[model samples]
Every structure is written in C-alpha cells, then in structure tokens.
Target: MAGRVVRPRQLAFALSHTESLTRDNFLEGPSNETALALIDSWPDWPNRIMLLSGPEGSGKSHLATIWAEQAGARAISAHSLIDTMVPDTLVTGALVIEDLIPGTFDERALFHLMNMAREDEAYVLITARVAPASFAIPLRDLNSRLRAVPVVTVAAPDDQLFRALIVKLCSDRQMTVDESLVSYLATRIERSVAAARRVVAELDAESLRLRRPVTRALAVEVLRDSA
Candidate 1:
C-alpha cells in the first residue's frame, strides 16, 4: 500500500526524566566528601544550626532536599521568615533556609527564629554560596548567631566527580553516553554541574536533530555552544 509512514507511540522519546534524588545518586569525591559526611552526620552535628555553603549548582539543593525529606523539614526563604505564620512553620523542628543573604534578611525575624529554634531544640540548615563568616551583616545579635553557626563547604567537583556528573546528567536524560566522550568533556570543561548539564542537554538535542550518535566532533561543536 502506498501510504505515509507513521511513527508509533511506543518509540516516543522522553522529553523529560525523573531525577532520582537519592544519596547514591550524589557523586561523592574529595571535593565534597567532607560536606557529604557532615550532612550524613546530622543530628550528631556539633551545632544544631549549621550552614551548608557551596558554589552554585554544586548539588547543595539536592543535598538540602535529601536532608529535608529525612528530617521532616520545611524549606523557607528569607522573606518568608517575616510572615506571621513563621512561628507555626518553626514548630516543624527542622528548617532549610535556602539562599540566605545576610544583609538582605530580616534581622529581627531571623533573631527570633533562631531563639525559637534553640528553645524548641530545632535544627536549621542554611544553604548559601558563601560561608556564614563572609556575610556582611551589621545586626549584632543576628550576625553573632550566624558567625557561630558551623559551616560545611562543598568545593567545586574534582575530575572524578566531574566525570561522574557527566554520566549522571546523561543518565538523567535517558541517554547512554560513551565513556570516551565523558572523559573528554570532563577534562576539557570546567568543573561545574551547570556547565555539564548545558553541554549534555545541547549534545542530546543536536544528536537527535541530526539522527547521529554523540561523537567527538559533535561534542566539540556543542561544547562551544555550552560555553
């Protein structure tokens, strides 16, 4: 029969993939080993109020989500602390304050929140791009408390972690990439998850559009676009 060829639903490509947020999925190496260890050592942490500091896209949010899920925590922002219901949220005993900037935060609200956390024996995990000590804050009480909070840092990914991230990122897109390509990209690209993600996504799309495998030459083109 002379007819137009039709594609079946069974062979449909997934435009998205579920990101499995598990401890195993977190690629751990020397770069972030101490940070991961500290996260795992929660509840036993020296200070109930701790700051997890890391560069952008270094999986801090992922670790925060993991901790929040385990601790039955509530994720809140600096602005949200000013809300009246904040007191109610604090009752959760576990809180993750994401992207807290010292000067931009509500001083009084944070002061009260810390007091309440201590009173209730609650734990606080504050994630930021820099350590608490580096924050520019003039509020004496708030700054004082922030200074005392223990800071755990996740350095930029090492070569091993970077390669692992390439594989994990590809896997997230339901793509099995070549090991040689991974090694090539890992060595050539900066050690950043954001960069890796951009490269992988662009490569996937480019390969699909051309109906070709992910090749070194294609990778070079995509890497330039990623940059």
Candidate 2:
C-alpha cells in the first residue's frame, strides 16, 4: 500500500469558451467557397429563397450568421416555425431557417412562409444537412417550391484547411499546441472540420484529466483510446 502509485481523479469542469461567428473569423477554403460566395452575394442573389446544405458542424450555421448580419435577417430554427409567427419572423425582409430536417417541421407553416416571402419580396435562407429537394414532403406544392430553390453544398475540407481547422479549434479551447501536435492530429484523425473539433475537445479533456500538457504523446494515447 505504501508503494502504490495514486492516479489523479478526473474532475469535470464546465469550461467556457467563446467561438467567434463573425464574418472575419470564418476560414476561407475551396470546400466552402461557393457557399461563402452565396452568402456574400446577398440581395444580389438570383432567387429570394436559397438553401445551404452540409454535414453537421460544416459551418452552415456560421455562414447563416454572417448572411444574417449582412442582410439584417432574423434567425430561427425550422422547428419553431408557426403559421402565425411568419409575418414577424420576416419583418426585416430577410430570414434564416436553420437545421431543417425532412419531415420534422410543419409543412403548412413553411408553405405559408414561402408564399408570403414571395409576395413580400423577402429573402429566406434555409440550412439543411441534405438538399431540401431530397426531402419527402407530403405537400406537393411545398415539395415543388423546395425543388425550385438553389442549393449550395459545403464539401469536406481540403488538407490546408483541415490543418488550419485543427489549429483554430485548439485556439478556441485556449490550448497551446505546436505544429507537431497539429501535424500528428492531421494524420491520425478523420479529415473534416467536425472531426477536428471533436479531437481537440477530447485532447483538452484528456490533458486536464491526466495533468499533462497537450503533447504528441498525449494525442497518441487519446486517439488510440478513442479509436
């Protein structure tokens, strides 16, 4: 008992960090160029309604925030759509409906919103994980309207962007990581922004738990244990 090595108990701390969603904080890369361009085009868009499609954590929300700021748009989740609130939601002449999952939101409310937006010449930006055209909407008219909207897909990040994302994610957590850790993670983890965020969070938590710095060795163990 006297020679036993005591391990530090891992305490869960609610670490708070602010992620900048401003336009200046956005990282530009080829994977999201079209999506970013669409947001920048703003009132000059070809259509009053458009859709942004990408996987989870693909910066769809961030782009929506940027467009919302520029266009003076109010942001709301698709699930909150009520027929009665459509008018007030579009008071700014622009609106962003985020995380629209197929068959989850009310069809009538969406249809009414689209019709009113058309009549009022208001802009609507819908963010979904997949193209809205692929959604199996029960309302034929609503399906037709969704099919007509232009869609921009955010592809997975490229190598340069992937590495940069890992670094940025670490910075967001206030972790002091060098190029060695960044390069090691780039090779070990999946090449996606979401994956980068997840691994960084894991590394931070593990480092805190083990009372060690975020070195390549810690990353190797964290990744191995996670895998």
Candidate 3:
C-alpha cells in the first residue's frame, strides 16, 4: 500500500539553523547573566530540563540553540511534534523544544514525553514566550510540575546590549554601522532586543536596495516609514 503524504500547515514561527553560535553571537548584559551561566554550565545532570521564556527578540532561541550546540544537543519545534508520528524516544541527544506553551494542553502526552527524556538521560530544553503557568493545563498538575522545573527568564535587552547586538549582527553580515547611527537607534527605537533586530535586518535589505551604506538618516527614514 502506498502511504499518503500530507503537508502540514505553515507555522508562523521561524527558526534559523544556518547561523553559527559564537561569543560574538551572544550579547553580554546583567539581564542575561543567569541564563548565560546556565548555558555556560549546561548538561548539569539528573534532570536536564531548562525553560527559556521571554518576549520575541530577547534572544531566547539564539541562546537556546547555542546551549544545545554546547551540549551536543538537538533542537526541535513543538509544532513538528504534533505533526509527526514518531515516538519521543527516537529523538536522541539533548533536545530543545521551541514554543512549548502549545504543548501544555496535552498533559498525558507531554508528561509522558518528559518522563521518557528523563529516563533516557537526554536533555530537554523548552522555550516559550509565556511561562507554563499561563498555559491551558489542568491547574494543579501544571502548577506543581512548573514549580518543580528550573525556569530561566530572558529579560528584554537593555540599550547597551541592544546596541552591541545590532553592531555584532551588522558585522556578521559584513556591513558597517556608524557610531552616530548606533547611538540614534539605541535611543529612538522600541526598547527591545527584537526591535533592534528588525531594524538592523531592514537596514540590510535597504542597503542592498539603495546601494549605499546604512546611515543614521537611512535608519530614521526606514523606521519612521515603518511606524
């Protein structure tokens, strides 16, 4: 019998694997210290489960992926888990489940999967924008389970961290960012690591379009037009 190939719905989330993780890729700031320390000292045993919850652009996924690499781990999205028929045990090595809130409703399945990972001594790193307590799980179980797990929250990066991140991202893309432009962006844009990222990405595209270096004027115009 020929099996059918069913295509799944296109998910709104985006995960980039092409990018490499280095110290340059990680921005240092007080906001990220605990998370950084956990990442630096990863594969800390018994139960290798850590939660990364934060708003977009807080570098949760980047840091998670970096930690996975450091521990020779593999990253997977929660949506794929729903679509696939494979057993959890088949997913070897350290595991990163991005957007874990979506899985909280399925208590039995999630609990089973977590237990399986624990039994096998494989690391499980789950990330979500919201904490687990906010999910649609049965109140008592969800509360108890979440409290037992080690939670690491990524705070929105500060201005210094944001500027450093933008500069590093621009450098990685082989683009030069002017000091005035960096200063202007650090103050004028939304106070978020994510906002800095979008602005820098737009600058990259616009730089290609205009065939000119990214400048303070270009940043202001693009950001204003975007707003």
Which candidate ranks first by TM-score, i.e. highest? 2
Q: Is candidate 1 or candidate 3 better by TM-score?
A: 1
lDDT of 1 at 41: 85
What is the Cα-based TM-score of model 1? 0.86
The regions of model 3 sitting more than 4 angstroms off are 1-20, 83-91, 102-107, 139-143
TM-score of model number 3: 0.81
Q: Considering TM-score, where higher is better, how would the candidates rank from best to worst?
A: 2, 1, 3
lDDT per residue (tens digit) for residues 1-227 in model 1: 89998975333253766776788788888878887887898789899888888888888888888888888999987665784656887777999898887667787888888888898999998888898788778778888898899888888888877888988988887777787899889888778988888788888888777667887778988877756
Candidate 3 local lDDT, residue 32: 85
Candidate 2 on 57-121: residue-level lDDT in tens? 88899999999999999999999899999999999999999999987899999999999999999
Q: Poorest 10 consecutive residues of model 3 by lDDT?
A: 11-20
Better of 2 and 3 by lDDT: 2
Give the local distance difference test score of model 3: 0.73
